[model samples]
Target chain A: MAANSRFAVAAHVLSLLHIHEGGRITSEYIAGSVNTNPVVVRRIMGMLNKAGLVQTSPGVAGATLARPIDEITLLDVYRAVQPEDGSLFAIHDNPNPDCRVGRNIQVTLDTAFTRAQQAMERELAGMTMEEVCLDIVNRP
Target chain B: MAANSRFAVAAHVLSLLHIHEGGRITSEYIAGSVNTNPVVVRRIMGMLNKAGLVQTSPGVAGATLARPIDEITLLDVYRAVQPEDGSLFAIHDNPNPDCRVGRNIQVTLDTAFTRAQQAMERELAGMTMEEVCLDIVNRP
Candidate 1:
């Protein structure tokens, strides 16, 4: 159960599209750039497509960005691939109810964890695909 | 891996110690509350001990918190078990260097991820074990 690498992979796929905007790129090409399999790249792309961050057509073998890179924040990309109800941290289910602390731990942690999630989202919102591409292109 | 439950598990171990202040508790007991194996509890406790958040006597049978619950923030617990130099998000290594995006993705992602990590730490810093335990105790 490794931390899902989908987010990293999604970002990489997006970066490649940004670098090669208007170019018809297949999942195989994206997979090669990401150094992962085409299936993984396609899965992430599927999520990205559902989120309307990217566009794909049935019978079409290529993909493209649905919006300008500057308009697409990391937060948007993160949410695009993130599990709808999953938290950054998960409280273990079914703690011993006989124990007072166990009986109440989940609720307690849920509140704090929500705050932590919001904090991370705020940071992600501050970064966009355009800035990421600029940083990469400007690197020596 | 599996989103690293160390933070939640560590908090559980601490809350139990707070509820049973001055009482000697074994890893097996904590494991029972955590619904996991004693080995896992011991591993997490070892981290807490190394962080100076908890005290363990060599050859002794149990452990306890080293500081007041209020003084032990979630940040302390997190740092105690977090992999040093690990980021919340990891950029894929060896992205196709021939591609401009691949050449610079790591550096750009690293900068953005670092900010996200700091934000999470800041939020964790604001929460203490005392607050956590109080919330649990006060729950209906």
Candidate 2:
């Protein structure tokens, strides 16, 4: 399966908005930096907008951060662009109920996978867009 | 993107081998419990074999774990079945070099993402197939 890059693109879009605060940053301009299509940037930006991370006027080329950079966690950005299900791992569907292991495996695996996913999310939650922007600015 | 169910299937397969220990657990039998095809079971078993997690004989219908269930962690099973790249998140490719954030974003995201992935892996590493088996056996 192809790796999902929506999280990465969303992060780039947000970083650009934060760094260029008070400026009109368009999808086309963000696309230039991401080296992808403006449509792709707009699509991700739409998710951010829906998540209330950014505000965009109808037919406008630019958007503004709805929350301060420090308040927006990477976890928030990840969830915004991720599918609504938002599970980091996928469980198989429909194991046979006749089999003991099959009957119980889903619940068993769910417990473990949830723990692992939460561990990752906790890390993302601890990190903010402010930290990301600071790292970008400090880069040589 | 479709949710990747390989991890769940692999865990289910391994649990069967453990629960039905001392029995010749064929791919067909495993498939019945997983509610998948024998071909799917064999394909995952092939990966486990290659990862040294299981031992399979040519033209054989069954296989055995390479180590005790207590010695095998979910992280081991996860890595065995995961794509070689194994990154949970993907970064956008080919950002413009002319853009400062673009040039630096990859590295910045890498550090943060790696931490999150490792956090999840560490959680997986802490939990063993033994724990999973116990959970399965204890289920009501």
Candidate 3:
């Protein structure tokens, strides 16, 4: 199965908004850059809108970043596009309680998984959309 | 979609083997502990086997750890069950080259995503099956 690409697409959309700041940038325009369907871009925009990362109107042809690009971290974008649960790893369901290992493995894995997830999130938190846009603009 | 549970299941299977070290612990027995189908257990066992983490034979009812549990890190188990590509994040495909951001967003995202993925992996690498088993054994 394809890994989820919502985070990447969201970043792309936001970068485009920053690059074209002050211009009316439609979902169709964003989709063209992302090489995805406009509907996909709109759906992500809705999530970004709800997250307060972007501003959109019911019939508007364009969206804008709600905050300065420097204020939005990749973590914010990642969380906005991901499910609220947002766990990086999934523990198995319903281990046999009668088994000692099964009875406690979930909690054990949870502790370890949480650490790993936080480590990743910390890296994301350190990177802002401003940096991403800068990297894009500076790239050859 | 449910987060992939193969990592949890693989860990469970390995823990079972460690707990029942000397006995002929069949796939059905491991499945009982995991509360999943025997086929599921066998399928993961196949992956663990191919990863050289376990020793299994055709028509065998049980498997054994290929190395000491202390030597098997969660990262090892994680990589064993994950796809060869094994990137934690997926960048969207085919951005429009005509667009400046599109031409460079992938490379920028790749750098950031790699850092996040590596941070998570390093945490996993720090944890071994021994610690997990110990955690399970010590749980009240």
TM-score of chain A of each: 0.90, 0.96, 0.96
Compared with the true structure, what per-residue lDDT tens digits does model 3 show for residues B80-124? 999658988889889999999999999999999999999999999
Please report, as a residue range, the 10-residue window in candidate 3 chain B with the lowest summed lDDT. B1-10
What docking grade applies to model 2?
A: high
Q: Cα lDDT for residue A40, model 3?
A: 94
Model 2 reproduces what portion of true contacts? 0.91
For all candidates in order, the CA lDDT equals: 0.85, 0.92, 0.93
TM-scores vs. true structure, each candidate? 0.91, 0.97, 0.96
Tens-digit lDDT string for candidate 1 (A60-108): 8768899989999999988998874758787777778888887888889
Off by over 4 Å in 3: none
**Which regions in candidate 2 have their CA more than 4 angstroms from the true location?**
none
Ten residues in a row with the worst lDDT in model 1 chain A? A1-10
Per-residue lDDT tens digits for candidate 2, residues B1-140, read 27789989999999999888888989999999999899999999999999998999979766888999999999999999996589989998999889999999999999999999999999999999999999988986
How much is the lDDT of residue B67 in candidate 3?
A: 100
Backbone Cα, N, C clashes tallied per candidate: 0, 0, 0
Candidate 2 chain B minimal-lDDT segment of 10 residues = B1-10
Between prediction 2 and prediction 3, the one with superior lDDT is: 3
